[model samples]
Target: MTYKLHKLLPAGAAVVAFATMMTNAAADQIVKIGHVGPLTGGSAHLGKDNENGARLAIEEINAKGLTINGQKVTLQLDAQDDAADPRTATQVAQKLVDDKVVAVVGHLNSGASIPASKIYSDAGIVQISPSSTNPAYTRQGFKTTYRVVATDAQQGPALADYAAKGLNVKSVAIVDDSTAYGQGLANEFEKTAKSLGLKVLSHDATNDKAVDFRAILTKIKGENPDAIMYGGMDATGGPFAKQAKQLGLRAKVLAGDGVCTESLAQLAGAAADNVVCSQAGMALEKMAGGAAFSAKYQKRFGHPIEFDAPFTYDAVYIVVDAMKRANSTDAAKILAQIPGTNYNGVIGTTAFDAKGDLQHGVISLYNYKAGKKTLLDVVKM
Candidate 1:
């Protein structure tokens, strides 16, 4: 009987120890954050850049360990691809809401972000866009919608001011891809150009998917405007500039942040030199921690940034910052804390106003020289 009792005691202790291990494992919680972007379309490179930024942040956060409400938590990134389409974006938004993500960071395009904002607002999820810059996005009165980049209202005027003052241009022609972002920026530019006393030669509209701009370029060539402003992404803007150069159109190409990317030189070739563009934030090299972030990013991703990575990277930290301040993983609590955020991150000091827009926005202007993007000026608005 003593021998049997001794054998059973060891088994009983092992079972008790196993139960304790299970309790400890169950104490750790999983917190998911959704990130949506176009991962399969023309803008896939930029979308992937945004996703990678968020992913890197999540990995780092998890490695360092996070505790919320006294419960150990592991961060998970739930990334979705919207293909840069408005309809797809809404679907992706719904999926994230259904997944019950604590927060979301994405829908990079203004067309995608604007429509997706309503769904997120309804779900009470905080949606932070790192690249969407259309003014109407924040003006829709959705308290949940926020962006790290400046709006077209500021970006367009900055580019127009540079064209009129720095380029010394007398007349300009305008072209837009007819999407929400492109047309909105072109409209703002037209308004400011007229205000600056620059002659408006003509304004033309094209679809975002269009590859050939020869017809528009030919028309503008006849008008012989001093410069041409293109409102579209680099996928189309590069081809537009290339076709214009091929047609012997000498007008300098002016574009917004969508066209300002590290890949532009490869797309536009020699014609890249004729392009002047505006990015809706501080230049990467000028960001407070830009150099260090760039090196770390390159080492991790094996490639340079495509323009929006830094913004998105800072966005993840801002979200985590709100989480820390709220002291809880509840989405509502995090959302409530975001409006009062005054985080000094990689992109510089970030604070949002009543409309969820950055309180102090900066636009960086660049001109391509010898097939490379060169900084021209930085304007604070």
Candidate 2:
């Protein structure tokens, strides 16, 4: 070695040697999984919850030492903030595609998911939406789209049935956040509500970013409906409920999975007691691995689970499972494998129907009492 140093290597030899060493250090094949949601707005908490789910799964997969075709692979998450806006969602979607991510896990709201789906389809990337419940998301005939939860087609009817038959309500008023998730669910619920012999008093529109719902609430209050159905996320839903209580409204607040988050209690405060919500899946206590998953999630994220974390967690596994079946990290191969997804995940047996929707989706009804979500019933569809 002393003699070799005396001979003096070429001027660029040291640089070349350093580059080779760095290359060897990063020899593991990296598979990028993109996660999109509103990480910095009113629904930021819910978006972060979804991101954490994907994060936990990626960490677990990497720790377990994933290998495909004898090549060690490291799972990497490329989380993007869409701010629950469709235009921003498409921008994030295009960025992920340009970055060559193998799969995508989000766009939590149906409004974001539906428009962003086209970008993923054009790029031949697999997109598994965890919380978007609008039926139109999967009905677009894009082979690249899939969802882990039930669609609004099922969720809306279940909520309407509960209101009409379970609560025995005679008349109801509806308010939507004007996003696809809100508007679609409201329309479906309105359809089923009318068919079930309940009088529909009024259906009003509210933007997702509107914090002051006093005007709409006052109008609905005057209608004297037995219940008020809201089709929006917990951000708006919680405030709507709280304001309704403040306005001395006697009508109970009802909503779909958009408002079924655990944070609803905190946001709505005392008004949470009057809020009832529905989720597009079974309650956590009734899920196959819900207890264990929730425990692990809390330990890792330092927070309680939100509504669709389990579904997003399972979505990560589904993407990895498709990769495993294909024995490759190619996006097209993974996309081809998604249609046959029959994974037994934390949410139960997740299988896609002809339209890439969950085949055996279940809807669970929940009510907030003492600032906690209590399960009422699980309706299998």
TM-scores for all predictions: 0.95, 0.94
lDDT by residue (1-381, candidate 2, tens digit) is 987776676646888999999998669998899999999999999899899999999999999999988889999999999999999999999999999999999989999999999999999999999989999999898989899998899999999999988888999999998999999999999999999999999999999988999999899888999999999989889999999999999998999998988899888999999988899987889998999999999999888898788988999999999999999999999999998889998999999988889889999999988998999999999
For candidate 1, the per-residue lDDT at 329 reads 92
Q: How does residue 32 of candidate 1 score in lDDT?
A: 92
Residue-by-residue lDDT tens digits, candidate 1, 244-325: 9999988999999999998999999999999999999999988889999999899999999888888888888899999999
The residue pairs in collision within model 2 are none
The superposed Cα distance between candidate 1 and the true structure at residue 34, in angstroms, equals: 0.9
Give Cα distance to truth, residue 34, candidate 2, Å: 0.3
Residue 96 accuracy (lDDT) in model 1: 96
- lDDT, candidate 1, equals 0.94
Error of 2 at 337 (Å): 0.7
